[model samples]
Target: MEFTCISCGNPLSESDLELSINLGSAASMEEDVDLSGDESPPFALDAIDDSETMNFYSTMCTNEPMAESSTEAMPLCERCFESLAGSIIHDIQRTTRETGRYNEAIDQLSTVTPPPPPDLTALELEESQAMAEFQSVQAELHKLRRTLAEVRAEAEKTTADTEERWRAMNEAQREADAACEAARLHAAVSTNLTAMLASLREDATLALFPIVDCGTHATICGITLSSNDWAETGAALGVVAFLISVLQKKLDIFGQFTVSPQGPQSTIAIERQGKSTQVYPLHMARPTKKGAVQLGMACCCLLHTIAEVYVAQFPDDDAVSFERDGHSVDLDDRSESAESRRPIDAINGLSVVPEPRGAPSERWDLSWREALLCLGRVCRSTATLDPG
Candidate 1:
């Protein structure tokens, strides 16, 4: 057989039925196994050569009880042998029908053999031509059936390949989705639980409130800059001053050098230029909503001078504000209320506008801390040191 049936995977053999019966149905076990791990073939079978006649014969096979199953004079096992016999009979009958049809087709073709050339009748010639044409049409029909079968096989293979790819893609997507979900859940748990963790021993407690540093308010960075520590605020401020001299640049030439603050309790430090002075308030008293990076040199200088006065007595938190939006009288025109230029009355036991700076800041060689100590000796009472 040139091909195997896809459904049954069996051989449609060349053996003729007439010869099959002559052999008396000798069943030989071919011992085939399906390596593809699918179901077994439906039947066991055998083949015989044609002898032009058909008949059947059978001989029972039995093992004598005394004999061992060895290679000495033995017949096939009955179960296997019987199964083979049945399949052979079926094959014979099937082939008989097929062969009969094949022969009739041949007989029909042989009936009108091409007549000897030139039989003078035109009608006879036409009949012979018609037969050739009919034969050609039958040949083409057979070819078409074979081509259609091949096309169907190819289409089925493509469909199976596409389905396999689609399944693999879906599996990959599911794996990715699972991984992303795991990461998201992990992040949520960390965010929710981390607050319960304790802070380190050296850490300082602060509200972490967003605050602004201004003339009145001091910040940690500002304190560090002014502490006479390495990169001391006094020196840094001087360096900034030197750069300002060289660059001759201004943030806003017409604008005041003050910055707005956004919080009520921010802290700040001050260091003056050309003078060694460092000071810090206990807390910053401005909000952070309106804040800016002050020109360190000028701001530090202004703050140091003011701090020298307030270091003895300070102003109430809201001592000075430039805004006069609600007033029609201008302090500039001197048409404002008589009290506009004057300091308000006492606040929290502190007086206002203590005094103008004594003589600009003295150029001192002592550290700011040392300077504070000398001043403290000159004036006792923390209350007097802070006039606020």
Candidate 2:
């Protein structure tokens, strides 16, 4: 078993001095009665057991109880035992001196005079008045707190409502700006296209007449057709139908255009077969339709530009830039020739024409599928152009 000094935690062996302390018995020191005046010892040394040495040492040492047994023994080196015994003797002398001082203090207290007691009735009346004032102040403080809370709530609510209104206004302004931009683009493209195709209006109508003759057997522009041919032709027809649909939507927007309490409203509603109708704000619809128109116009412009270049190179042809009915029909004499001249003259004066832009030293050749794709690409490029 390992043993160490309780005070310093130093190693201890069997040969070390054994210092016994009984903390439980030491704690009962105050209960021991004095027998000095009767000529008898307060404790009879002969009646004590061998373990009673620890209790006697404990009573002569600290006032606090220790956790060990009343007869517990501690082993310490000779030097540690001498130091502890000296400390215990010094404490006992100090306690004896303190006891003498305490007795003198008690004799002085017995001779001193005491103050008179307070008047009960007057103190009771003052305490009651003070308590009443305190309660009244508490009630007023509580009322003020409630008022402050209500004011803060009102201020917070007002701030929230103002922020909500501000957000709504900003949203409406953004929508308005978008609508205006789309309308501007739509107006510009539609006007230019209407002017450019003014002469082609009659020709385009005549081109459709051939479709009626095509009937069950598919033939367009006097060429033999197959299912694929018909599908491609249908795609072309879809392009025309798309234009008419856009026009109808534009008319609807104009018709429904009005001012309300909320603000101005104009939108396009598209109905799909066997599906729910999709509605769009005018700003979104206009830009979308404008893109489609721009692509179609790009194809038209390319064709017109090509014809203009051919006419400039071969001015002696009896037929105008375009042929009709296997006979030469002069577009120069057409009523809209003045408007057509602008685009033609502009193309003729270009430093580089569209044809030379593709592969150098080779003419631009395109298959039917390639042509359709190229037309789409050209339209996208043109749509990005700033009308201004």
Candidate 3:
């Protein structure tokens, strides 16, 4: 007869049928004995489906037979048979583990005693005391906060008062500084006015000298001039040269000609094209024609420089000018005429010609007096004094 699985209705292989027949034989051998009489069932039927293989195993282990006509209905495919066997083995292992755990729990219960319950009264008292301390601490914290607020308010008031005092002090300091500055300015103005008055007095005194005396009877530094007295004339000329040098320095005049005064031995330097030519001994023991001519030329050059300075200061005024024979005394004038003859002939009566012999001292004194008169006019104009 053909055999098939009762669970899935699939034909069973020969090896499956052979394994089932061996299990049946083993079940028959144990039919007379009770395999599960003294202990619980090893496999749990609830753990697997109630399939035909399960039912077959259950009946065989209990020594129960199926109906005669349905004896072969217990056949199963290999897959269903393996699944059912695995479920039965898993249920057996789980039962063994549960039994072991129950045995361990029983052994521990017999060896150990249970602990007593806690005391509720002492615990309740401790909780109440802890709550009371917390309340006290909270009250102290509130009191400290109030004290801190009061201290902060006092500090703000003190700071405001300090600021007011500082502002007042600063304002006073500013007023004092302003007063000092005003006093300093007033003192400075007073000093400047005093200095100006003194300078005016000195200039007034200097204007009274006889150096600028342009009359027919001229005197030099209180000494009268004579035609024959060479010594007196020479000394007068030295004084004139010294005065001219002083005037040049006072006016801050600088140019091609520079004069250095040493009574009777004064010198004059003429610079042209960066070359300097010096003439010395403006006053000699016995004046020669050549010496007189050179002295005259030097005086003309000095006068020319002074004239230029005066013109610069008073560009519009033409009252006082240095001229000789109707021509201005210009040292650079190189034309052939009376203009060229200067500065040698710029001063009148200085040269002693052979045809009409004249006293050289007298001529020198006249020329120098005229030059000094022109210088006095310049000084007065610069000082804002009366030229007369």
For each candidate, what TM-score against the reference?
0.20, 0.29, 0.33
lDDT tens readout by residue for model 1, 1-388: 2532222334323342222322223222232333355543343232334322111322222122212212222233334434656866687779869999999999999897786877568977898899999999999999998999999888899888888888888888888888888888888876764442222112311111111123322223224222313234444344323222221222111021122121222223333334554433311122122211112222332333222223223234232222222232121222334344221111111222232334433222123223333333322333244331
lDDT of 3 by residue, 92-163 (tens): 678769989999999999999778887899889998999999999999999999999999999999999999
**What's the number of clashes in each of the models?**
24, 1, 0
Better of 1 and 2 by lDDT: 2
Q: Pick the candidate with the highest TM-score.
A: 3
Error of 1 at 220 (Å): 44
lDDT of 2: 0.43
Q: What do the candidate models score in CA lDDT, each in turn?
A: 0.36, 0.43, 0.51
- Across 1-388, the per-residue lDDT of candidate 2 in tens digits comes to 7766555666766555333333233333433635356453323332233345545444333322333433344444556666766665565567669989999999999999898889899999999999999999999999999999999999999999999999999989998999998999999998997775553543332223222112112223333222223344344433333323332232322122121111112222434334565443211112333323322233333333333333333345444323332333343442546444533332333211144334432322222123323333433333334422
> Which is superior by TM-score, 1 or 3?
3
Clashing pairs in 2: 295-379
Give, for candidate 2, the lowest lDDT window spanning 10 residues: 255-264
